[model samples]
Target: MDKLLSIVIPSYNAEKFLDNVLGELVKCHNLNRLDIMVINDGSTDQTAEIGQKYQDSYPGSVRLISKENGGYGSTINTGIAQANGRYFKVVDADDWLDSKNLDRFVGLLKRTETDLILTPFWAFNDKNHHKHIPEIKPDDISWGQKYYLKEQGICPVPSMHTYTLRTKLLQENEIQLDEHAYYVDIEYILYPIPYVKTFEFVNIPLYNYRVNQDNQSISMTNMRKNQQQHSLVVDHVNSYIKEHADGLNPNQQELMVNRLSRMIATQLKIIDLAPIQMATKHELSSFYRKVKDKYYFEPKDINLPMRWLIKSRFNLFPVIHYLAILKMQLVHY
Candidate 1:
């Protein structure tokens, strides 16, 4: 029998969380419509072994693919290629879905025939994280306005794992992951918005996104490559906005500039503060120059310290970073 849904989990050193996540997923009572694929992206640990075990235990329902490390984009592309289900979802190895809401989401997609179904998610802040907030209102929202109202609790971060996209829509649009580490969620979700025939947002938080100190997310660490990836993501988004600007009216354009500025500023912040080596400073500077002209907000608009960091990237960065570190040490001591 053909499957109704294909859940793709890209795993690499996810042994700590893979077992529990898969365990919860298989326990779904109405899994008759669901199929699973775990792409073991060169796991140096027992992730592949555990995935193989699940494949053995669940026979037809689960399958594992072993491949050399090709980053997340390749893993997702491989999973999409192998999926035979009518709909596809990309679930990160670290995150898990709420069993109760997962069923509801799938059922809604099946019945409503929407091109995409988006559900809200909670961010588990490993660094003094706060309580989860709900975003959906009864009022109808256009796809473009979602970002501007994020601060007012109306905008949502796409839980790439939580969304259920019609397989045909993805295949038709040829929407795939990019060579980015941090903003794959943004890129995938944003690229599909202009083409979506219909979209529905469920207020229920169906996924728990863990933001731990040890996590590889950009905000958690200061890796130079992550910073570069973010810069590339910003450029991609800018191009999208430019290409589709005609679709947005005046007010929407202003809102877009505001949202895009805030987003670009955040990415620049990562690049400016990253503990990057002097050798890679030019890449960061080059990216900053490319997007610097496009932002609605200028350097003076930002807070003083951030302004200093962005304006003085080449020379004063090391001095500022060291002083900030010293200041923190003094306070802690």
Candidate 2:
């Protein structure tokens, strides 16, 4: 029997793009190798109808579930629970994979049986017909090199929404998404990164991420939600470093902490400037304290400006942290 590959798609009001996304999956070079499961998250639109149409057309190859709206995290968690494949993958409703590269990926997985495989994605805009590709060293790449590629501005990748993970890892870790308005992927993706023993990356672009200006997921205005999610990811990563990452030199620690601090500052910008509920203030304060206490050190030990900035707001830095965060988006866009 062929090993089953489960592809989970969490959808919400995505009818406009679901057809194109599902069509790519159906036309993949190895159709028999995949079991596509799409959990329609209470889409108030025709998303459910579209999914049903695909189910009718593809029958056993495609399965669709219409569940109540529960944000992206809950939707993906539900799909993961129902998946029966030997390996699993996730695709955003807005993104599509390159059908031409499907067989190459499946063949690689069949041969290596790696725990996780990450392939590069093409981020495209309406002005640019071709996908924007990120740079990476061609050969002699280590897992660490591939992992930190984004940090050095070489890979410039985030949101690994197209990764294929072995089912055993999910079952083993009992991995589930956190139900925050943001950071769902971080909880599912980064939380597991440090623990992965056998991970691989392919240079080929297997996914297309549509970055149209009108797309809700790509809105530059929703900086608050995006930054908060980014903060949660960085905090989780920093914690992972302290506990799991060992034998790091001073330079590496500085680099990691610097990145984490910058992300925290950026997140503060989102929370401070955005219109959020009053109750969220406490939650944000708690998060800030956790990060502050963990990283607090003598001012003289590091960069002068960072030290002064950290000290000037000693009690009020979290507030200033939020203000400076407004410009934090400069790093991303």
Model 1, 45-83: lDDT tens per residue?
999999999999987878889998877877877877778
> Model 2: which ten-residue window has the lowest total lDDT?
148-157
Point out where model 1 deviates above 4 Å.
125-162, 180-182, 223-225, 240-262, 274-289, 292-333
Per-residue error (Å), model 1, residue 217: 1.7
Per-residue lDDT of model 2, residues 172-288, tens digit only: 767767653565565565545543555566666777877644545434466544775666666566765586457444434443444455556545445545444554456556656
Winning candidate number (lDDT): 1
Best model per TM-score = 1
Q: Each candidate: how many clashes?
A: 0, 1
